[model samples]
Target: MPRIIDSNDKNLIGDKVKALRKAKKMSQQTLSDRLETMAIYVCRGSISRIEDKSRTVTDIELYGISKVLETPIESFFES
Candidate 1:
């Protein structure tokens, strides 16, 4: 059987990421630049999609985000 994902939870992490980014007073472009510095080539639009929960983030990308934001992956998933 296929595992069903929760609709509400789909955006939880993304929302958290957005919140953290905003709390840091950082812009999406800066985040993208940081990701690039870490060799993660996610564009600004992709970041936007991520913040809005329209895009699914990969493990590597998540790692990059965690590192850049100085936040743990667990924090991103916390509701």
Candidate 2:
């Protein structure tokens, strides 16, 4: 069967996430650890996948990412 989403990318904010994370000099494991504090569990491997656009992000995960990155959720969608 074919996939529901045709695009190769799994999420829209992956690139932005990578950019912001690097701008803050934050590592993937650090991001994951921080997210865990908010009760959002995304492992370092998963975060690497997210940054590579190979992982889907839930709403709650996105919220935790924004909080940890200190970025607005809308900014993730911005070009």
Top lDDT model:
2
lDDT of 1 at 1: 71
Candidate 1 lDDT over 1-79, as tens digits, reads 7537756443456888899999999999999999999999999999998999888888999999999999988988777
Provide TM-scores for the models. Answer: 0.88, 0.92
Where is model 1 poorest over a 10-residue stretch in terms of lDDT? 2-11
- The 10 consecutive residues of candidate 2 with the worst lDDT sum are 2-11
